[model samples]
Target: MNILRDVSKLVCKTDRRALASLLKYAETGLKPQYVCKGHMSLASQTDQNEDLDKLYRMVEVEVRGNDPAVLKSYSWFTTTAAMELGITVGECWTPRKANHERLTLLKSVHIYKKHRVQYEIRTYFRFMQFLRLTGSTANTFLEYIQRNLPEGVAMKVTKVEITAIPSHIKTHSEPQQLELPATVEERNL
Candidate 1:
């Protein structure tokens, strides 16, 4: 099977608004100050629109509009969009003191799948570099974190499964294998 072709379908084209909002939520972790009017109208739908609403509230601090309903309908659109693109919502991603503040640090990625959907339950070591990742778990992200995490970094991980059902568990055909990077730098956290 052609792997690049399979993966490019998801990576090349993504909803810009949704991606932007998700990234912001991962960074700041705050609710929105903007008034998204669509939120109230679509409160019942458990889909992408809802995910956007929730993420906007946390990321978009500007006054989006005065409509209270719109503001509320802005819900968690992350899970749906990520699944369509074969991605998961990454957790526990943070910037740390690394490389004289030029890079970010993180731990190994822990991914979860359920009901043929994918949402990331892993950490991101947001650094600048080109890397390759191929597997169910986010081993690529971990590779970046490991490679660029300066001389020292600290991360903590607790092995507790989340209550929410994973999105891609049903589709996995067998046990997975991770093609990890050859060099991995360790940190204390």
Candidate 2:
């Protein structure tokens, strides 16, 4: 008889606006241009727009097993794996403060056991990296997980699913401006 149950979903949500701002700042190297609105050539702008759109995308991974201990270990290992791959990972906290407080208290009071594990990859580059690393196949991803299972832990991964979620945030490219100092003193300043 099957005794293991799927765990509650663990999601990692990204702030699109913040990510856009950071990307903009990184490209322009000027704080003022971070939020400035502008545009570029159609072809180049389309590419930039695509990249920006990707920044807010997400990839959901689902894994199932029959042993809570093994599942838990696998979850922890995958979290570390994501970090090792230079991916950003974070828990999605509830919007309400009261809910946060209640969740914290409840979590502290009991140890929840889960069989199914799910998490999200919230960045475009990281998601691409994950696909590249895993050979862009469900079997490969499952094998990677199975191979990395905690030393002595053994569990059958009944299913592994990967889903790509597109970004809802609209993106536009901003114009880049550079100013040259005319004098040595101005350049130093």
Candidate 3:
């Protein structure tokens, strides 16, 4: 029973170390070749690097409106469109006043209510799919937004920006072997 308990404790410690190493890799983007007793083989590393090289594009649309309700409706419309197009829609940022100046009492209150909202639509694709996303595609997306805008609201698209995120390719090399110190019991033995 004592031997079994010691073995279980050792296993748990190893598991914890392995999980921590994986999490470190995720957070810092550092590729760890040795995990516990297992080795991240060269072929696996190459495959992972290849997958990371894939590109993703993000489309940011800026919309301005005077009514919060209209902006909410537009947000829903854009989310539905992104789903239909098989893309991901990021959360809309809180609407901010387009003009920051304090309004005088004589000025129209309507001018002070102007707000702007930004939406991000992201799509991940391979080389061929990326090629399919061209200027016409953006135009089509703009036309869709323009056509679906809620009525009775003075909403207008301020700007549309598209940017691509390309992964940094790293050269693959052999990982140095780390020497671990012996456990207390092993050292005593």
Maximum-TM-score candidate: 3
Look at candidate 3 and tell me the lDDT of residue 100: 40
TM-scores of the models, in the given order?
Answer: 0.16, 0.25, 0.34
Model 1 earns a TM-score of 0.16
C-alpha root-mean-square deviation, candidate 2:
26.0
Q: Point out the worst 10-residue segment of candidate 2 by lDDT.
A: 1-10
- Weakest lDDT window of 10 consecutive positions for candidate 3: 123-132
Q: Summing lDDT over every window of 10 consecutive residues in candidate 1, give the lowest-scoring window.
A: 53-62
Q: After superposing candidate 1, which stretches have Cα over 4 Å from the reference?
A: 1-135, 158-189
What does each candidate score in C-alpha RMSD? Answer: 29.8, 26.0, 24.0
The candidate with the higher TM-score, 1 or 2, is: 2
| Cα lDDT listed for each candidate | 0.32, 0.40, 0.50
How many collisions between residues are there in candidate 3? 0
lDDT of 1 by residue, 1-189 (tens): 242243234332445553354345436754333213333211232233543211110111111222323322321232233345554444312244222213333333453332243333322232111112133233433343335433223322222222444786556677789766665553322
Residue pairs in collision within model 2 = none
Give the local distance difference test score of model 3. 0.50
**Model 3 clash pairs?**
none
lDDT by residue for model 3 (51-73), tens: 32222354556555555566666
| TM-score for candidate 3, residues paired by index | 0.34
